[model samples]
Target: MGIELAWTHGVYVLFVLGIILMMVLRRDTSLISIIGIAFLGLTATGSVIASVGGIFGSFIYAITELLPTILVICIIVAMSHVLTDTGVNETMIRPMTHLIRNATLAYWVIGIVMMVISWFFWPSPAVALIGAVMLPVAIRAGLPAIGVAVSMNLFGHGIALSGDYVIQGAPSLTAKAAGIPVNDVIAASIPLVIVMGVVTTVVAFWYLRKDMKNGMIAPASHNPVTSSVFSSAKVPLAPGIKRTLAALVPILFVLDVVAMFVFDLRGGEATALVGGTALLILIAATMLAHKQKGLEQVTTHLIQGFQFGFKVFGPVIPIAAFFYMGDSGFNTVLGEVLPQGSHGIVNDLGVALAHTIPLSKEVAALTLTAVGVITGLDGSGFSGITLAGSLAQLFATALGSGVATLTALGQIAAIWVGGGTLVPWALIPAAAICGVDPFELARRNLYPVVIGLLVTTIFAMFLL
Candidate 1:
């Protein structure tokens, strides 16, 4: 060893460099990169034993910290499934179909529907329900499977879930990490989300318009009402009454939204109201399905809901863990055994860069946005957001920059990239549900998401 380098600064630089390389190369998941870094850090500290211990320690910490949140997500998804099996999902979409007579209108309508529902109940369940019902109609109306997937991914996952304005889930996480009020984060995120949404929607239309102009797309195979999934299964409600309820579903949802706004119920309260309404609809649908089978059917739906929830959230844990280590709040959860000298790698590196790098706030905002985009390559938007938020706080302090603006820029970038736009894995559910190719969806989303991120970033630099 040539006079072994200091573990403090050098280790941090190498760790960050590894993350950048992993993202640029688009290699395996971030979890793999984290493991590699952990080992490297261990070696730099001259202790293989310590590295092994740290890995296990980190794993344990992540599990404990995530359990409660994961359980909540599971319960919520389960409830949605119960609602779906009861035919409430169909009821919700039925009225919307009347307004969407053409492919162009269908795309925007579905996007809007997904966004609204997702803002309350979340995107996981919203995707399944929307895909199962509205997709076929959109397809028949002339929207391509790729188009539908893009709409759902952009609206539900990116726009709605990213801002999480109603439920405040995403904003709450970012707010907690930044030690700010959840309401403040929600209020701040609104303009940023709108800029991103408008840019993304416009770019998507531009790309889609090319396909439309070329006339290269084939119309979807049309199936008659009697041959459809709903037709095959006997619905619980009487035909006339069920149709009435189907009509009423949209009205109920609209009422929910109106009530939320009227009451000024911002976050968890809004989510609870939506969830409660969904539950009532679910019960009614179950009873209608066949009172005899309702109980068993509800159980089955819950199982499927849990399955889907785990599928979406499981891979996120380790990724979240690696980033969580960077935050002081979660540092102790990583285990108390680590030496006090083991500084947060992300903060330490950020501080080091702040001192050396000379840049205006505008430049720093852009840089932070780019960093968020780069970190998002791992394909978990929230993970990238968490990391970006932590880094933003560091950069804000060092440069005396606008913390909210930098944080919001990072929020926009991370969500645009990892929230199912550029990454194949992140787009998997929407693609699969829409019966489109995942890689193609990723490609379709590339230009629009990038342009949206750029526009929103520039807007943030000036507006905030």
Candidate 2:
């Protein structure tokens, strides 16, 4: 039997095209997205008032859907800020610097440390922490500043955020959209993440070395953070406390990891565990740093944390809302004026393609990965993850592949691309901290990440 098509599907297709065009033109889709939501509402409800209402509804829905991720990142960033006050954050990387006596070693040392920290702290905090503490040493060791940014981005945002083994936010978002448990997404993504990470990082190092040998690298410049770190410390604390906290932080996180394995916490639960621990640590660190003023310090940090969190997630909410409706069920929450069996906006399109395209498993796998890459073009590695996740469910069912594997594949592609490697704006924090141009940083990371995504996508096909 042939499947029937609907006008809503066409609207969805046009909205997707609009979104893609906006991304391709490197334009912000916020306005376009708002317009699309209005039009979609008009078509569904056939009422101007309903259409206007849908705009607010979509944003609220997207924010509600994404609150967990936003909160976890905010709290983690706040916790890192608290650590910085005690100069304890620097201590975390001091030993790692000893291992990086040269630039060759600096590349891997900074990258490995970044990947580890990013898993717990999220890439935002990890980049800030690593950029402040490690960039100077890496440069001194002979690594270029662009090289440092690439290492930080590829490891922290690409590898760590993609797998998200520690925090599980990425996987959680992907899993939720796919209607699967977050643990399954996390477990399934491990191999894909490993493949992408190893391949990309190795390729990056090879390029870094070649650039140095050819003298293609620019002379390194020190940013203010680097100068500040080398300048002074008011408190004359012994190395023992720093060492203890460094040791303690990892142990506590490791325990959290173990508990995740043992207790089998899903994404939200695991996030709660990590966030709660981070908050407690933040409190303790503030108390130690400010003795009497700790209370005020903690409050100040919380406010700052929320501000940053809202800032990061603000743009994302609308984008995610426009896409979330691609999931059939969300149509109801956004105001169900569409006909029966809406199957979400994106899924409807996926189903249409499935019937018309005659896609092989390989093609389907690549297509999902391509869609993920396209979504990542929006420059928020996370904004399009839900769509990728929803599409994974659609494609897997249509192609007779495993949903978890395909979902992981899409997640990997979206993150590695938009997660900071390909996006100049996303690379700014690392690049700016390293005193490198963000565009140059993106250019440097482009080849390795692209090759890595291709390889990872193909590898994912076999699993599917």
TM-scores for candidates 1 onward, in order: 0.63, 0.66
Q: Cα deviation of 155 in candidate 1 (Å)?
A: 4.5
- Cα deviation at 291, candidate 1, in Å, is 2.4
Per-residue lDDT of 156-200 in model 2, one digit per residue for the tens? 888988898876788999999999999888889989989999999
**Model 2 stretches astray by more than 4 angstroms:** 1-5, 101-243, 358-464
TM-score (C-alpha) between model 1 and the true structure: 0.63
Off by over 4 Å in 1: 1-94, 112-149, 152-196, 205-231, 234-237, 244-252, 262-269, 276-280, 312-333, 336-344, 360-362, 371-411, 414-447, 455-464
- Candidate number of the best TM-score: 2
Please state the error at residue 191 of candidate 2 in Å: 9.7
Total clashing residue pairs per candidate?
2, 6
**lDDT, each prediction:** 0.63, 0.72
lDDT of 1: 0.63
For candidate 2, the 10 contiguous residues with the lowest summed lDDT are: 223-232
